[model samples]
Target: MRADRLVSLVLLLRQRGQLTADVLARELEVSTRTVLRDIEALSAAGVPVYAERGRHGGFSLLPGFRTELTGLNHDEALALLTAGSGRGERVFGLGSALASAMRKVVDALPESHLTAANDAAQRFLFDPETDLLSRRLDVEEVPKETMVEVRQAVLAGHKLRLRYASRGQAPRRCVVDPIGLVTVRDKGYLLATEAGTDRTFRMSRVLEAYELPEPAQRPDNVDLERVWAERCAQFLSEGHIAVQVRVNPARRDQLLDMAEAVRAETPDADGWLRLEVTFQDLWHAEWAMWQLDTDAESLAPPELRSALHQRARAVADRYRDRP
Candidate 1:
């Protein structure tokens, strides 16, 4: 702990050139007394650091002992020091980490811009959702530390023991060699190889993760990005549910203009539109059909189409009986 403070202190003094004890303690998360002890340690190690005691006095290295940080311009320095406060805390974990690192950058800033860095850090913020579709889904019940370790294992090319809960079953355990980590919106995925087969484990679905003694080995000649894309394609393809609908050319054109893909022959001569698209297992297809009304006609996929007609007929029958 003392060593950590000492190292951070040296780094601080070298980059900052001069800093008040109060400021160093605040940045280092230690007391002024602790910072003083650290300064003494640095001095003992012949670091050429010294302290001043008066009101305007603080710590500064002897002349010719100052070290400067590399390659940070004024705006860049300000941006780095306070880049996360504006983004409400739930965006990217790595972004949060970078924000913490930015504080260190602020500490390293030249005295002339210290005030600006402090001001910027307090005001800088970003929202990841502005560019992403935010959705909430069931995730595994694992601790953040466990997830961090699992991610590190994937990066380190290590095998992991995963206790996962399946969609409709109790928790099952499996051993997997992690190859990559994927962030699909709010979901976290660990792309791995199990028994020579590629598998993806969702982090939120994981109940437990254990690092195995087997050194992590990456798969040979495998392109993880390609594999992940293929998996996503397959997932989308599996959801293909056909729906046929009747809509006038005016409506069909409007739909097409809106980028909704139309399936089968588009002419529909009679103003009917046939379209098929992928949908998740959880769907409100019938309700959506009802909402679309006469503008949408379910043409193919006999089961859903027939059901739609029957429901319409039933509604008519109910009206007739009521009259």
Candidate 2:
């Protein structure tokens, strides 16, 4: 492990030219003292590493220093190819690029590991868009150019002029600072800030986008995963309607997904589950229960139960005469 970390330290300096000890330690997940010791060791070993004192100075290597450690191992190559194969259909308009990269990876693998990696990669299949019933998940499709534009703005750290489609309203135009792009379950979302307020936009609802020359106003040290988690938690904490239900054990996972939180649970004698769950709203609660069909029963908030009853009755009445 020390050997690998040393090699990584060299690679980072080579690729990025110069870095402070604190930055290097953070990148390598080590202490600043450890980074200093590594630097001394590399210098003693004639690697031409040197440090400069005072603020605005860190560590650097003599220009043109290089290493020969760019090859990916069999497992790494296989992981890339497998991910490429699975996400080929939704790669932000980079399907061709991914295919070309995969080919290069396969060609670079050693003869001994080639066949085994290929077989391993082919054994796993991922197609989340198609459910067990063979029904395709309904998702809005974003134009390739729109996705590309949003990506460029985010990468370039530039302001973006966006025309967005809001539900039940006309498409509105606004200028926002593009922070990042993320894909969840094949659906894309852009996290940005509008007028200094955090906002998240569905990529498919983006009618058009133009990258601006002006730079975006955002913090330099942004942790995207942390930001995304915070946004998700905030969204999940509001506007929930609590209810109780009795459902088949088999559909517990589906119920959990629909509910914001599960407050309590009790196992029924007949193997059904009685759960106190909170859904986003009355309509949402009704919709999820209806989908469970005979396998579940909604048991609280007379209004939700009443809505479900009316919906079920309407369906039964429609089929009473048998088409």
Candidate 3:
């Protein structure tokens, strides 16, 4: 850990040119005394670190010295910059580290390619609070402490005890053998097992988390992508409501994209495309169909159609009575 911290200190100085002990302490999550000691240690080890004494004075390396640690090219630097813009870092509690690393990456770039790469990177944006259609992005709330504990357990292969509150269900205590953590659409989940049964728990729903001292009982080499895929398949299959819908051909692609497990059937005689899709439940189906407005019609599971009708009628009644 000290070795890593020392390396990070060198890289930080190399990236920023000059920084005060206070700034270094804050960035490295250590004390000013520790920063001073590390600075002395770096100098003793022939790192050429020097300190300037004044309000604006700080620690700096000899002029024209670079760390030679990161060798990112133009495109690679831009890719790292773009990834740093994502929300995953915030969920994983690496926001500050990512910011510091990005600064180093930008500073490490060749001057000739720096400005152009930075400008080109501005063309791509990610996870804007509001999308093009004026719909707000969904950002799940996960407690920082909870996320940190869960992440530590998953990475260290330790057992985790969590007080989970599933929707519409009372909070329950469970001990899990964590396999990995996954983030999808800005939401985080822990792919784990309880009593040898597979379970996926949303980080948002974790009311409390504690890492156990015992090592987790999990596969030696787990494939997180494969596990996530299997979990998704199971989630879509269990207690899911299949809805048959007829959509205008022009809007067929939109409907399919919005719905899960979509299967295209022959177009109806009226030239509308028929599709069968599965939704997590009735409310899930209703919400999805609601987004299509009038472009798609739900045709099956009479209850779903009735639910939509009632919702539309309720909206119409509200406006009808307003006048």
What number of clashing residue pairs does each candidate have, in the order they appear? 14, 0, 0
104 Cα displacement, candidate 2 (Å): 1.9
lDDT of 1 by residue, 1-323 (tens): 67656766766676667799989998787898888878888888998888787888888877655434656776877765544454423332354344345545655566667666666656655433332324333233447667767866766767898899866799998888888777654567788878887677777788888887787667555687898988776555564554555665545543443222334545566545555533333244566566567787756567777677888999998889552
The pairs that clash in candidate 2 are none
Estimate the TM-score for candidate 2: 0.69
lDDT of 3 by residue, 93-183 (tens): 6666677667667656776567777787799886777755576767888888898899899889999999999988999999999999988
Per-candidate TM-score against the hidden true structure: 0.57, 0.69, 0.79
- Residue-level error in angstroms, candidate 2, position 51: 56
Best by TM-score: 3
lDDT of 3: 0.84
Candidate 3: regions farther than 4 A off? 31-33, 43-59, 69-74, 100-116, 126-129, 247-273, 321-323
Provide the overall lDDT of each model, using Cα atoms, as 2-decimal numbers. Answer: 0.65, 0.81, 0.84
By TM-score: ranked, best first: 3, 2, 1
Model 1 local distance difference test score: 0.65
lDDT of 2 by residue, 151-189 (tens): 899999999999999756999999999888888767788
